[model samples]
Target: MAAGAPMGAGNSSRIYKGSGWKLLFPSWIIIGIFLLAPVLMMGVYSFLTKEFRGGVIWQFSLDAYDQFFFDRGLFGDEPPRLEWTYIGIFWRSIWQAGLATLACLLIGFPTAWFIATRDPKSRSTWLFLVTIPYWVNLLIRTVSMKFLIRDTGPLNEFLLSIGVIDAPLGLINTNFAVQLGLFYSYLPFMVLPIYAAVERYDFSLSEAAADLYAGRWTILRLVILPVVKPGIVAGCILVFVPSLGAFLAPDLLGGAKTFMIGSLIEEQFKGNAGNWPFGAAASMILLTIVMCVLLVYARNQNKVEAR
Candidate 1:
């Protein structure tokens, strides 16, 4: 989501005056006109039929909804394929996104925990080191992962040298690569929220739990997790929703055999079978999913706060 706008115009030469909510008007206007307005327009577009004459005619029709449901557009082959293609792609994207979310959580949680355990003075240095990679372009990172995992790359060379395997492990252009890319791209998202929560946790609480005869595992399961649940949930939202619609990573790190909702929608806009309204509809579907996930996350976070 984008930032909201600022409010009312001010006098150029006036002394500093009292502040009020009016200062937010400009930001609100920008968001209303840009982001929210576009969403409302897309919602309308999703309901209309896709016209072949380069524009949708102004008529009340459920053709788009029916085609989306039954996989038969108005201008398709004579005998329509009577199955919902877009819906199939949607479920596949959701499955891959689930895998990506699990991958991010597994890798990111440990990293955040490690960072949280560091001294206050050292935390910034460690976080900077981790966050620095994110500063580079995402496309560059995807390409870089490919280079590192290539058949003749150092990783393969080192494995062969150590006799860990007779041949290099096939780790590129597969689901494994897609998972890796997702983890790498979104790990910081998982880490920062968790780090913020964990870093501020009272170390004394664990000590108290231990004094009460609670073992380390017991303290972690009982005390630590509950306090940091909000951060974990926030991180999950950050990683899960974006990975669910991820396009670049799948295209760059994996083979064409794997295509995500993002890449598929991208194809609708830019490919030989380009269809803008259909792409808009597909995008809105993913967006709807994202909004639902966010709502659930926010509710959970609020409950945690209440506790």
Candidate 2:
């Protein structure tokens, strides 16, 4: 009877483990099929030669990478010269994304603090209002911004009515317009993470700092920021990464004059100029940058967790 009992228990344990794997099998399959496969294919495509017609030739070549780094048209038939056009585009993307992230942080931190300081019953209501923008499609929101900021838009009408300016400001089709769209779209992402951190914070620390005669700025700089660093880091990552690859907002707001990497990539793939290989290479480069950011974020998180 004792031997039979041991066998039954072992069988039950095996069944439990098997069931756990069974539950996870579908997720693993979906990830491999949908996510991993596409990324791997893109990586493969990046190394291939582009067909003049509109597709990749599948012959391995580094022409796409060469064009990205070098290939000044000034060389003519000679060897490719170093041109910084693509590099400039990359820098512009980074700069725009950084500015948008900074704007979100500046605005979000205060907004988050406001929500966090609210009573528990009203906190949910305030958070809900913050998220109201998400209810509308991003495309719709961006388009609506165009209508509001155009020369003939309500914003100009209001300013003219108030006698603030003699002429209507050209708000659309400018970098400022693009930044505004990005800030408006991603503000919620920045706020939510910071709000989460603030909600979990100990206000007693700030009170103790105040008791020690620390000024408001000093307390905020020393006591509050350190504790909320993780959330800030998280919010920055969320805002910066998407803003870096932002497509719709830039396309709609910045116009043809302001060319971004996202627009460049779109042109290569779906636009009149269909060079899939070059597009794939550009995507890989962007992915590498994002991965670096993620690694840095992960390292910072680990350091915070250790402390």
The numbered model that scores best in TM-score is 2
List ranges where model 1 is wrong by over 4 Å. Answer: 1-19, 51-61, 72-84, 301-307
Query: Model 1 scores what on Cα lDDT?
Result: 0.81
Report the lDDT of model 1 for residue 209: 99
User: Can you tell me which runs of candidate 2 are displaced by over 4 Å?
Assistant: 1-22, 72-76, 304-307
Residue 203 shift from truth in candidate 2, angstroms: 0.9
lDDT of 1 by residue, 185-225 (tens): 99899999999999989999999999999999999999999
Work out the TM-score per prediction.
Answer: 0.83, 0.90
Global lDDT of each candidate: 0.81, 0.90
